[model samples]
Target: MKETFEQLGKKGLIDILVVIDDSGSMTEEQKNLSTKMNSLLTSLKDTNWQIGIVTTTVQASDKCILTLVKSTDTDAEAKFAKAVQAGLSGSGNEEGIRQAVNGLKCSQSPWVRADSSVAVLIVSDEDNCSSRGADCPNSPGKTISYLTNYIEQTLAREIGKTAGIYGIFSPTVNSCKTAGNIGYQYEELMTYAAQKSGTTVSKIFGNICDADYSNTLNAISSNIALLLKNQFELSSAPDSGSLKLSVEGSVIPAANYKFSGKTITFNAGKEPANGKVLTAEYNVGAVPLFTKVTLKNTPAADTISVKVGSTVLAASAYTVSGNEITFKTQPASLAKIAVDYRVAAALKNAFQLEKTPIAGSLKVLVDGKAASGMTYDAAANQVVLNPAPLDGLAIELNYNYRTGPQLSYQVAIVQGAKNVKLYDGAKELSYT
Candidate 1:
């Protein structure tokens, strides 16, 4: 069977909205964004880029950044320099993004081009206040989902894909707080923003408290450039030496294309013309740098680039098509390929799980009973667990007994000065 390539629509023209937090601590951060705004455009070549700015908090004057410059604009450098600024008085960041989207779309400024790809760049040092009426009361806060829905569905719905969210926020994972500047409950929303595309997909994450945004800007700019260039992943890995790429049935010139693991990136100005049929043929295991497998493309699917052992590879390390998985590099032949991923908490009960031939089988106990309701479909490579496991149950698989993510630190009872026992759940390895 031929490997089918899924081509995404060209995002050559993109409209970007930058939403920043404007509280007192943000004075310095906003200046970095304003002064370094032009640095982001360097990587976005051959792209119809329109830039705008907005604060995460809504202010008294409805301050939203207007379109600064298009890729084709003359003296675009000066225009961008003139329009981008990080204000220090925003107060409604939770619903601020929603407001900005509406405001930008309705503005008379020629910033948002018709039918263009969209990107929401959020920069903040504290957590967001998106409540969306979930448990929190007495405040007009929007839920992360509500904001994501608007960004993906309402704001850029016509683009046929979710707008890219590039964020430089306080670290929600293993958070690091510097001195008096801090946040309390924004990790969930920051995570939601990164995972808004419904995949554990990799997006930009920068420390909002950092003094230098040079690295963040570089990473974000590179990501945007790739998105705008319409880079596509090969359905499977091929030997770099034997690979043949065809566009419109004609083999493309070697100079026109380059290979980064499994993704064949075309140089700017050398992209395959539109309506062209892109295809590649490869030997599955030829000096492989990554592995490939098909997976279910559902919101519940653990369909993002996976971690093998201690390495957390980026999404670029995996080429996931409609329902298959491919890796950018191959692991050791003896090494087990396992990924610990997260699924949406709202998955349907008794739902069948896809991603066939998983590295391990399901070994979860529901309600204190060995889970017997779960069955695997070999043909479909899915798990049929009827009456989905109850919420809040930690369902983990022990495929090949590889060390997965550590849940937490547990205290062990000390029998003597040198005799302490460590345990994982009920399994004790040793005592010394």
Candidate 2:
């Protein structure tokens, strides 16, 4: 089964991406998110919160304003407080959620953690037309459930699994009014997505036109607090039996931990204590390991042994075939090519020069003697001597010639024992 893993058994970051509609009608609503920022921060005061915001204006660089990072004194207050007031002309038909996902792909925030739970918050008063489709005037557009599923599926395909989708929109029919955009058909995706995330429709979806946003903001923050759980998923799957966990300096019993599928969860009372470091140790290597090797002949089954550098490995760990070594399960980490074969005939010439061009400064030596009366076609990159030298005669040609296709890693001299020599035309290369 595919599972997300952490390096050295360490967990990833906790990231939250927010999408705000900057339409003229959303002025007070956008300001509300900033005014209640403290409430959102207070809800997640326990962990490192990576928060970012983007507009639904369909701008090129709408992924985020990185300067608006929370929990830091780096001007996030100014940036986040007045983001919607930046005069970015937003499209009246705002596609906040869709635009947020698109912005994440184009201009990703640096704080986004690979192994973190991602939640997208859309603050809009319109229905979602994020997915490309035909006009919705004649026919009823896709329902909120279909759109929410599409969004989660996209997130799962792009950014691992998602925890929740929190949206603040006019969920009730005709509960709010917008100029020209009458009725509440605008943003039903909010309620649909809230339901898709296992949240009650009334719990996460908020009324867009509410004056005091304490209730809606509280709901959004509560769901975000629940979604942003600190759980480390192993980057590489490990043998469950070989796993051990610890909190601070105390080793925890296996009974305190619940391991199933590709992720491990701590028992209710066994969760990591506050300010305490939780670490795990396990043997991992879910992916097959491939290595380039050289064999004097066909590798014999009886004499095969696995050794990396000077470290002898378990005999049952690996298999050898001709020039390839495959490991059934790799270790916790892999380094550079450390098992290079000392017997490898390295720095050996591979291919012979088929055509060498001659020029004024070009020099040619045949059988260690200077040869003359040669004709060369510089444009064709080919040279011809008055009489071709015999096969046994040593030929040295120096000229500026056009390079050919890249050389392959493996080259075979099928019949000849003579070593091929490669030269830069000015000097010898890896081979002389």
Candidate 3:
């Protein structure tokens, strides 16, 4: 799972492009936007912003405004209201997304700022005719993907800039009398903007039929303001080399920010403002111990013991194969477990059988003579000669038994405190 963290910051410079559908049927909506200009202006009065207008028609004179009204202008609200009163005599074939893109391209001079965030408000009651077909036969055939790519690859590519494209159109087919096809392409564009900005589509869209535009406009402006954060805190410490940062939808160059520990601080004059989607992707540096463990040596039969913390575990609690021990159930985080075992090998005075021998199926000899006092230790699965043989004595032991080496392990569980316990066969020891 990815560890994520988010934060909202103060306002920043933004260029607002209001794309209005000036078709014949949009008279009432045009009046609505003009009358509700105060709601939009009041929300952005305190911001370092500018407003521009454009019509969804190919007519050269009806395309876009060359100049932008800055927030600093005393008559900014008046200028914006007048601009939104675009007349209802333009073409019926409304290509809002396409015209919005055109407006940005043709009016980059005084209308679009180099480093400011961009917000596109498409006020329409019709679906976008971005692609070629009956929807808009005379269209440029630019798809929704093309328009969004322009925003990401061209507009947002500027060092810390972002773009939020919102839709003020029909939400569902037949949801409103004048709406056409529910503005499917337009809604898709808004959804894309919301995703790149780390917001929900609901936050970036408004139903064109809404009685009042106050709430929706305010919410959109507020969310756009949050796209201005210059700093963010990560949920966990991340590997420095694994960090990858992106703002809006464009990848930010590594040199654009200073990532240290869990905090990321953008370089001077390089903060984002298009959307609230500033993300830092990285791998966590630390992890917890989970299940299996490896041993230093292979254990001999019947000599295995396991423990977690200070609690001894039964042989049924774990299984050992070669030098790896796998616990039946994973120990809790930070729980200490200890395992001890005797090394398996053929040694001097003792013979540990691979398996249990058949009852009375044994013989013993020392120096070519029948030897006595020999017994089997079931616990160790070993054959022992009582009082061990004299030095240099040729001893022989024969037995009918099964196959593998006799091995055993001891484990202990110790919880609480900051100590680890280990067993060395004869004694239990603790170390901090």
Candidate 4:
């Protein structure tokens, strides 16, 4: 039982290498690196994992140096913890590509076990080596090509018949030529390398300290979990006496479904087989409270009364043939009018406000027509105008508010509001 548990645990282990750029420009990038590493380390600590670190710069004697830490042991973990605490300041003599590839290769030795899968996490500006020498070429394409080929060949030979790789590129160097030339070359090289090695490459820019980094790492972990799940499925045998079926329709028969090993079986109750097509109609739910309801299948000339709670708000009919519902007049109420007019803005923006406040008895006009019971709030920068006795009319805002370079606003017409044209000030932004 102990051996079996160990085997199960071993199958779930994820061996990862973290290759970071320690070049001159990477000094500023170190903050982001530290944050990302800490978050990743914290999240991955509970799992059976190992991490190796490598750095790249032009100052070190060795171009590719590996800082291996035995993750399974306490002493090694402490040592590695110290190294990571030292952060991304260590310098190296080469671009990170070679070192990262070599580090991953080192992890795949025969002693490491053939069943262990390897993944690489590259945090670099992607700058190649810039050692000033007559033999050193300015172009990084050749170096990149060699690294890509080497990684592909190594993974194919060592880890498994099928192996996966993942990479993350920092925004410090994205272009091929710049003040920091390594960034661009690094990106290009890694992109090609990832493609050749069947790896997933992600480019990170802006604030690396944000929750987005954690989210991205979580997504990668989820993907790794999926891969492990697939492996488990492949190792299991299919049950001989079971038939598995997948249904996509809304209606499903009431049956007992069982899964034994790799086979799924469905046992049905004793019910007479009716020749009629089994149908299930699901109401898409209350048309989103204050939002317009554009039915895919419109009703006929005979209108249908739509109610909110016990109050019969408005009755608008549509012509429905097959799966399409085209309504004549867009549905609108005092409470739901704002949702029908705001276009291009997110649903959450309905609550946004400008500086000045528009009081309770606010009014609206569309193309010189009076619209009643309109709601306006200048403090939140929001306005809702709807013509009374709803007849598919357009509403416009003619209020004074300060505009800034970064401030953005959107206006949207209700789903079925006909001949509606929304304008930003006098500029006619959109028509629906």
**Per-candidate RMSD, Å:** 30.7, 18.1, 23.4, 29.0
Q: How much is the lDDT of residue 294 in candidate 4?
A: 51
| Candidate ranking (TM-score, best to worst) | 2, 3, 1, 4
On lDDT, the candidate that comes out on top is 3
Worst 10 residues of 4 by lDDT: 1-10
Instruction: Write down the lDDT of every candidate, Cα atoms only.
Output: 0.57, 0.56, 0.71, 0.43
Give the per-residue lDDT of model 4 (tens digit) for 313-386. Answer: 43344444433434465444334321112222222213234444423434456546765555665555676543
For model 3, the local distance difference test gives 0.71
Q: What RMSD value applies to candidate 2?
A: 18.1
Per-model TM-score versus the true fold: 0.44, 0.53, 0.49, 0.39
Best by TM-score: 2
Error of 1 at 290 (Å): 57
Q: Write the per-residue lDDT of candidate 3 for residues 338-395, one digit (tens) a residue.
A: 8877787544567777767766887788888877778889889887887667644788
Model 4 local distance difference test score: 0.43
Instruction: For model 2, give the 10-residue run with minimal summed lDDT.
Output: 131-140
Across 1-432, the per-residue lDDT of candidate 1 in tens digits comes to: 145453444535667777666666666666766667656765765455777765565544444445465666787766554444545555533444454564456454546644456776766665555332333343333445545666566665422243566666666454547512233334454455445444342346577767788777877676666456455555566765677777657877778876766566676777766656677766766544446754444223553547677677787777655555677677765566665444534654443343333345555556666767777666664555676775447554333322565445546555565646566699986633
